[model samples]
Target: MKRKKVQFGVMLHGPGGHMNAWRSADVPSDASTNFEHYLSVTKRAEAAGFSFVFVADGLYINEKSIPHFLSRFEPLTILAALAPMTSRIGLVGTISTSYSEPFTVARQLASIDKMSGGRAGWNVVTSPLEGSADNFSKDKHPEHSLRYDIAEEHLEVVQGLWDSWEDDAFVRDAGNNQYFDKDKMHELNYEGDFFQVKGPLNIDRSNQGQPIIFQAGASKKGSGFAAKHADAVFTNGGTLKQAKDAYKDMKQKAVEAGRNGDDIKIFPVLSPIVGKTREAVRERYKEIQNLVTVEEALAYLGRYFDHHDFSQYDLDAPFPELGDIGKNSFQSTTDEIKRRAKEDDLTLREVALQETTRETPFMGTYEEVAETIITWIDEGAADGFVLTPHVLGELYDDFLNEVIPILVEKGYYDTAYETDTLRGELGLKFKENRYTQKIRV
Candidate 1:
């Protein structure tokens, strides 16, 4: 069978792509806390014919550097405000299964989908950081395996709640003193290992029945959960071969779990710092790098992995042997760095810079950047990409004006959005509930 065409999305945070993105002189530093900044970016994305925009979430700030990382509006609240501003792009917001209740999450997501006319998406995450657990009244984070188990149950309950009120369940008929068709409403009464949720959700079913479910997990258990439930999966593989391998494995896992392999879309995050010329791009990258303080990088790293005392390492010297960082906490990142260094014959300092930043070969002329994305798509490495702009609005503007036309001409991207609803744009058909089994008397 012929492969499907690639889809595209943009991942947005404070001012732009990553935590250090604010350092870019062109990006407004205060945009992280400014609602108008978000609105501006959203308008740009919608006009560009982009598929969606995503906002990530975290529950707590790092104890060591609270000042640097803690100033952004909550994702769901921001997305709710964004719902009415745009007409076509999907609005995805992350919510932690480890900290939120099933019913509450279901209600919030459904409400946003309704408010957006079916353009909401939920990115389910099982946070592994310990600080988040402390905020949730737990002294320690749960084991990774146990957390995945809870996520599985949580997702099932949420889906059940979303389906409780069937389409046409509410008649709003007042003449006959009948407000609803009682038979059309069903009770979930879900009893599971991690949670017990009873009955139908208080809110009505969304226009799309449920919000699109996005998952971002790459570990063994994480990949499994994503294959079984995610409408789309976000991953962070740095090489084409690695992305292809991961995508193939995920599809196989989905098939083994009795799901259609094509049901789950794989999107890898690509942070491209584009410019009109290679020299210009390099100059821009250097400017952004200069603004990153060691303190800020270390603060961001400590939150995601082991708490490294980066202050001790010389800025010009090679990274010291990472002998003390917790194996479970930083193993994947360390392994990736080591592999890339050996394969590319890069120095330790260069490896550190690459892993800590977003500057890459994708940062060149418009033709060069577009060619790189087309190459990746043709390689069967990903269904599409989640573009992470290094500077607020600049990368997006450049892409829309310079690169989108090329993609459209090559028949690799859409010239216009197919529908206002996210589900329709994503090619998801609304199907009748198949979980209900019939009894043969």
Candidate 2:
């Protein structure tokens, strides 16, 4: 099957994606806060023709929080720092609507878009951790469904602010002493249930117009929001079957929401452990599994369940019974964990270890891993993937030198960038300012 080119984005999870990655002797323990480490890795990814670099974020952390989460660069700040350093690769960073103002979020992203020559993307999210409310000065976290309701309105306001100025508003005619066309400028006097923003945004539009919108909403309400608004959707893509189901469902939802199915791209996270041989791959995986104790695994699992103390239950016994406990925080992920425990009859110890050191389908010899990736794209399971390597230093190098060459040779992936902006590279259209369209109409 002759398929179109597949896109790729790397997740910049310092240290690595594994819970105990920081403990490895090869990985720098302070990689989470080391700017030089990120700079070097980002430059390498850019040279290898990655479409973007994604920075995931969180608002709150506890004693049980992962090492990277305990101390990490603020998403937007790091993206901004990386902007001038890289040329073509998109700079995407997470920002939560639950605890941020629309005007501020809109302006900050627009600044990055302008500075990066239009290579900016915003990953919109609603902070799900209950402790986040404490940080934001609230009595309790918003209910699960209500948070989505707030997110819809919050995103609406941000988009409206982004369209405040038309394309030709700055008609810099110095001789005539005309700095801008007053008639072309528009104000977004938006008043939604959650926010009210009256703005003729201080900053102007970039070449790609507004920054690209990315969302990772896997719950029913969350997925609906993504279908309606996001330029791309991030998913877990648990297996071949699951990935296909998610891709088809998301496309259908986008069509139903009055958008073209191709407008929204699906990118599942793939944390591969690559090696020259199958034995090497097995050894690498075992090294990662041995780094974490069972106690640490249980703690890692707790984060998804709103920090529910898994230690209270019998580790060797069947998984504990808890209904609607994690509904407010990471609902879909928590539900899946519960369902799998029941379905597979896994004990608490088994489930915890499995979640902490889970192996992906993209693990094997270089050629085999390359084939699996190509199969997913050719089979319509994914538009692309977001690589979060299990072993950053070695696996990333292995993928770049080994598997990537195979994908490039087979005509499934490109080794050079085709466009300047994130939207252009992703096959998405440049967003026109709303005011400009109104004037033409």
Candidate 3:
């Protein structure tokens, strides 16, 4: 097979990435909690040579929790279940640092690595939902900077625990009744502002070394954190220029942080609503939008705008002049929405409805979608696309059957996978154990 030039990962947000996905005829309404549904998607992607399947999770859920958010498999549990079933495609799970303990996450991911034969990745997140703190016995979610701080320390502790034992730590020497080399075990003794984890992990380092780190941070602090630590970033660049700029910024930041910039691959999110023809694409797009009622669209907007119920405001009127930096939800999203609304002079209803019809890679024929993705990759705007199949069943199949062929024909996609590990497939270096590095030096 030709050398793989672009990396691709899939994120199935339960039934689908779209808010109205469950209502689509192709998808099962109960797909969010169904194991078979999840497995089928992963198996399909693997057959098509996709790089990874990411199971995203969150702690907070309310009336507004969309189909996937209302009830879905926790990321790690789902990935663990998928580990033994699939062989080549990477299994990446989203984990929030704010409400989790480092040791627990570390052990679980290590187990996933072991179970999957080293094809495991961790998509790290700092939960920013306003009510997420309530689930973990707190009054409010920690402020943005503080959450990132906790995230940085939380990851430090986890990585330290991962490196607790050298690769040669376990011997299993039965002749002398000696199980392992005692000198190979190293204590973490990690004392950070947020945690004080005192020793080695119960399990040894995984086959791929540390689990590959994946992050999707759009804010300055969030992007900086990713540049410093993440192996790959599921980037959020709203446009081509934005994507290129963000990619450059991350690579530069990585270089400044004393790491090879190219080691951090940036995958911009892609949602392709494709059809056989341009008219069919538009028709399908309209159908998806029609399923979302105004009430639902308002609720969706409310979630993005710091939980300020948009229902309380005039839908046809311009978005209220709420200046940036006053919300507990996603600062970057809120700011972007505000900027777009202001620039276009869009009504609240228009803004909310537009968001409801979340389409990316642009709605068009399959060939058009494929061209857009290839252009982005070739132009340095992205390493590849983190595809979020809006409605899983036929939508995902169409992409695999249609768009991939164009890419394959254009010599932009490989006919076969290059490596078993996600790190190897993405051209990332295996993480070096701290103690092992010291010994070599």
Instruction: Please give the lDDT score at residue 61 for candidate 3.
Output: 80
All candidates' lDDT scores?
0.76, 0.91, 0.85
lDDT of 2 at 25: 76
In candidate 1, what are the lDDT values of residues 243-288, reduced to their tens digit? 8898899889989989998788889887777778888878877876
Rank ordering of all candidates by lDDT, starting from the highest: 2, 3, 1
lDDT of 3 by residue, 93-147 (tens): 9999999999999999999998887888999999868788888898878988889
Residue 49, candidate 3: Cα error in Å is 0.6
**On lDDT, who's better, 1 or 3?**
3
Instruction: Give a tens-digit lDDT track for model 2, residues 30-53.
Output: 988989989988998999999999
Worst 10 residues of 1 by lDDT: 432-441
Candidate closer to the true structure by TM-score (higher is better), 1 or 2? 2
* Model 1, TM vs. native: 0.91
